[model samples]
Target: MNINIDIDFGNLWEALSAIGTIGAVIVSLWLARKDGKKKFQVVLKTTIGMRNDNSIDETPYLSIDAVNKSNIPLTIEEVGFINKRDGKKVTVTNQNFLIDGSNRLPTKTESYSLAMFVFNQEQLFKELQKKWPQGKKIRAYVRDSSGKHHFSKHYKI
Candidate 1:
């Protein structure tokens, strides 16, 4: 008895074409995802010691820093905190800690650079306490010029 084998070159070519198309689609998708993602980070710092710039400021203050970790520059629009309990937002626009006159909002930050906003800690605490008594947890946030918000970890006030 003899066995017979059949080779279908047409079907083999069609299968190879389908595989190539699938691979091309996958590579395109991967590249698109990698290029479309944006990176942004925020850091919150608090200082209780006296600050001396022009005159000695004995009041404590809170600093919210917006850091540009991406390769591109980003603009910082505002920096403030949110009440964790009631979800209330507070925007700090006055009483900055910088004496060099460079601490302004809507500032541009270069790659690996940081833009910071400072506010009187006691003033902010009193304002927050008026709405949320007995203290509450708050998280710092920075809003970009594009209206995107970046947040930091929670801190008790």
Candidate 2:
């Protein structure tokens, strides 16, 4: 039996190359979105660790989880908090830590959580509790790797 090798692998190589690139892109997008979703997940029940009649200490315990899904890993970009008080909405700087693109979050995942303290600025909570009239509310903003808005939710507390 004679062996023949007349196949033209040029097109085959090109097709494989193109498919690889597209697969990589789709995987990258999936990973990015996954990372975005894991940016702000709570590890513990939302609670104000310490508080007083005149003051309160807020401690936020959170665990950020992201599935790379891509052939590459993702990095945590930024974190911020927004508060609306007395008809004025302001943005506050919050610290952040790196989150692992792997299914297993980093060891310091607990540290990624951020807590803020507000004396009477949290009138919204009071108002909702009927302690005060309609007032300001607190909201959280979450951004993704692409600098695009991903998460925005208002919390009375």
- The candidate that achieves the highest lDDT relative to the unseen native structure: 1
Residue pairs clashing, model 1 = none
lDDT of 1 at 106: 70
lDDT tens digits by residue: candidate 1, 56-134: 5666777766778767788887777787667798776764434333468778888888776666677677876776665
What are the per-residue Cα lDDT tens digits for candidate 2 across 8-105? Answer: 76777899999999999999999888765533432112434344465765544332222223233333344333454543333223222211221211
Clashing residue pair totals per candidate (backbone < 3 A):
0, 0
Worst 10 residues of 2 by lDDT: 98-107
lDDT score for candidate 1 against the true structure: 0.73
lDDT of 2 at 146: 53
Q: Give the TM-score of candidate 2.
A: 0.29
